[model samples]
Target: VYNISKEDGANICQWEYWGGNGQKFILEPVKEIEGDVNADGALSVIDVILLQKWLLAVPDAELTDWKAADLCEDNIINVFDLHLLKRMLLEQ
Candidate 1:
């Protein structure tokens, strides 16, 4: 659990539990790695395989970050993206 200071530069005398948006702090944006469909913080054959399974409509197939798999920068997720993912893996 994390509690934020009530005001900037104020001496925090006491801490309290998070009070939803009223006390929540802005979180740093997470940088998503391209081709990392599983959001494992790294790109590898596992990501490629996950994207492939998602495209093939395999049961229980899920993409943690579909946008990361969009290597082509196109709105569609198809064989082209899969090819690009594989190429990226080969390059790495």
Candidate 2:
């Protein structure tokens, strides 16, 4: 837990670009597919278990396809991502 000293909010910034001169934005390739953490061509309890294990720093529990596991697209695997995975599994 954390205690706040005084301020209860923070500021955010946004940027807009009107035009560019022959410049392009390149996107990094995503993982093989979404939610196939173990690369078994499917999403199952084992996939969730493997992802959880990876997050827990379990040896050899590495995610075969991290892009798929990073369902939130935040470039990180966290509890929120875990929740997304669960929702997907439930929906199936």
Candidate 3:
């Protein structure tokens, strides 16, 4: 299979799997889902919970993609985003 080299400026070539991070990669573009704060490829209650925890400053709580939580497109995550996310979830 084709493998990507870890060394900078190295060329990609056929290589056996060594179970490294560079061994595999996505060739297609990934579409980010709005409100998918946890970035598990879907919007759900779990994402809401994560966002909530992150906003409340819960230790160790992290958002996979903070931009996804910016429902207002204002480059900020806040109560407004949470409100909109809840509304979107309810609509779905």
Candidate 4:
């Protein structure tokens, strides 16, 4: 079972039955990828491809966690984020 609450006093409760066909869940904090601007687990050519897609305005719900990609901590993910990621990778 899981309960989600918002700051406005609204809440939602949901439960999953214990069965092979039932849903499963894994909870974890968003990781700080060393230089993966696209947050796909690693900094690689794939990350660059994903970033290019995002820059072209692709609709990706997974990339909504801007904090993981906002490498500069400027509160917005754009070319600057990519630059920061590049810098981090170069430093390594």
lDDT per model, in order? 0.83, 0.75, 0.87, 0.61
Candidate 1 residue-wise lDDT, 1-92, digit = tens: 23334655545433565455445556679887888999999999999888888989999999989899888897889999999999989999
Q: Can you write out model 2's per-residue Cα lDDT over 1-92, one digit (the tens) per residue?
A: 01212233423223354444222344477446578888888889888888889889998888877888889898988988988998898989
User: 23-66 in candidate 4: lDDT tens per residue?
Assistant: 44445796677556555677776665666677678777246345
Candidates in descending TM-score order? 3, 1, 2, 4
Judge candidate 2 at residue 47 and give its lDDT.
Answer: 87
Whole-model alpha-carbon lDDT for candidate 2: 0.75
Misplaced by over 4 Å in model 2 are: 1-32
Expressed as tens digits, the lDDT of each residue in 1-92 for candidate 3 is 23445555566776676887766665668899999998999999998899899999999999989999999999989999999999999999
Off by over 4 Å in 1: 2-26
Model 2 Cα RMSD, Å? 16.0
Best by lDDT: 3
Best by TM-score: 3
The lDDT, on a scale of 0 to 1, for candidate 4 is 0.61
Write down the RMSD of candidate 3 (Cα, Å): 7.5
